[model samples]
Target: MKRRRVPALLLDAAAIVAALLDAWVHVDPDDRAAAACALLAAISLTLRRRLPLLTYVLALPAAFVTDAVFATLAALYTLSSLTRRRSLLVVCAAAFVTGDTASWSWPGPEFADLTDSGNLITVTYSLATAAAPVFLGQLVQARRELTVRIAEISKARESERQLLSDSAQAQERARLAREMHDVISHQVSLIAVRAGALQIGNRDPETKEAAATIRRLGVQTLDELRHMVGVLRASGSDPVELTPQPSLTDLPRLVDSSGIEVELHTDLPADLPAAVQRAVYRTVQEALTNVRKHAPGATATIGVHHTGGTLRTTVTNTARTRPALVLPGAHYGLIGLRQRAELLGGTLSAAATPDGGFSLRLELPVQDPG
Candidate 1:
């Protein structure tokens, strides 16, 4: 639950009304000096938020000249709530006590009557009255500070929990990498070696070509596996890359190797940031991969162009010419691509065209070269 805050204007208005009421009870308008001091004190409450000390000083004259003490007490409370200077508060409280107890005479207040027993009781009561607002103000200040400290503690605990969760995830990834390296890699290696042997032994042109393609793809898979293993082995504390990440320069090779009819066109600047280039490349790669999985025997077009400070990339594919194979997929590729684009201060959008085609568009802001 949250607390509703009072409007400053309303609070100031209330303080002014309270001060004027106190004046009505204790001050006589016939005495111009007392009336003027009380009115000045009432008006000074508006400045309490910005200049608490000044407001307190301005309001003190009313406590000395007349019995109207509401404005002076309000100013004191405001000052105590905002400032941390204990000694200054003590002095101001003492000044308020003295002003409330002394008698107004000639040029200044007379304290001769304070020596009497009755006057001493009056002084003690004045001291108690002054301490009331100070204690209340200090309590409010402490509560405000405690709220801020609690918020900071909550944020710290949340960060700690996230770090622990990430550590557990990293451990799982490492275990999976070990399994792939020790088992899957061995099987793939055997396949590649046998494929190579068949390509060499067979004289038939079609068989040799198929064996060669298998060997090539197996070797590429092995390279990617090695990279993935390295990434898994390295934790967040120490980042290590076994192979360079793909970027715009690799887009052409990626399109060619995708095994789909893709027409690539790019008109990007040569000096784009590496992060921006990688984001564009990944967005295109994921779009093309989705096309391959969902739209079999489809022709695709990829267009990447830079205009002003914006980089735009679009991937579109025609409707499938053949039925899509029932392949197992988590369907997280586009979600991951959209998150990546957002991380780079960019956007990713995908939709089905009116012609029964799929289209993906990515737009990113580029940093100025100069």
Candidate 2:
């Protein structure tokens, strides 16, 4: 439950009332000097929050000449809460005890029997009374400081989390850009090579002109792709492996090393495009990775097929038999895979299955080289 704060004006009014009531109970109305001091002390509480030390000093005379001490204690507490000076607080509290323990007489204030049990008890009681407000004020100050520290810590944690998320996203974008360059450049190089061969071997002038045009354009596109790849590569510090990019042939090895029970099935043609094969491989890899991370001890089934001019890849996983362990992740696996598939003119979809399972599917158009 939240605590509501009291208004400073209301609190000050209440303190003045209590101080006036204390004065009425202890001091004789006919005592002009003591009555004036008590009235001044009670009214001084209005400045307690802003001018605590001054307020306490103004209230000290009343505590010495009369029994109206509430205003003095109130001022002491306010000063203690506002300041961090231990020596000053100690002096102020001792002054309050001294004034409160003295007895009022016609001439002036004087100390009673220091050896008597009653006087000793009076000194002890006065000391305890002064200490109470100081202690309470210090406790409130500590609590206010602790609340500020906790707020600072929470803000720092949020900033750290945002930085981590941004770093992860940047790294994932760079990786996808590199992979896209690899697939597009490979296919473009093949086009340039075949067009060059046609230009050299063809007999007709018109056919040679067309082949030369295609080869020239392909080479220009490849050069641009190379420049893009260079920029992507320079942005990261890690050494990149351009060769041995994942393909369908690596799926068997990937499944074996995935550390889970997985069934692999494929009816794909032997001559699928490198981009298509890579998309399938990456989709399956991300799916299997998700299963291992989010569904512990779940069995998965993978299917890849080429039918009716489309290559379809699907990975389905059963409900987990055990609870998944909590692990830290950059959370970019699925997002990167989706962008990879989109770059290759493919579509990827993932969703939870009806039986407390999961499924991810990818579909890419396949054009036969006649």
Clashing pairs counted in every model: 0, 0
Native-referenced Cα lDDT, model 1:
0.90
Clashing pairs in 1: none
- TM-score per prediction, in order, is 0.62, 0.53
Report, for every candidate in turn, its global Cα lDDT versus the true structure: 0.90, 0.87
lDDT score of model 2?
A: 0.87
Q: Which ten residues in a row have the lowest lDDT in candidate 2?
A: 1-10
Off by over 4 Å in 2: 1-6, 106-108, 183-370
CA lDDT, candidate 2, residue 167: 82
lDDT, residue 274, model 1:
88
**Tens digits of lDDT, candidate 1, 130-245:** 99999999999999999999999999999999999999989998898999899999999999999999999999997897788779878998998898888887767577665677
RMSD of 2: 15.2
Give the number of the best model, judged by TM-score.
1
At residue 98, candidate 2 shows an lDDT of: 84
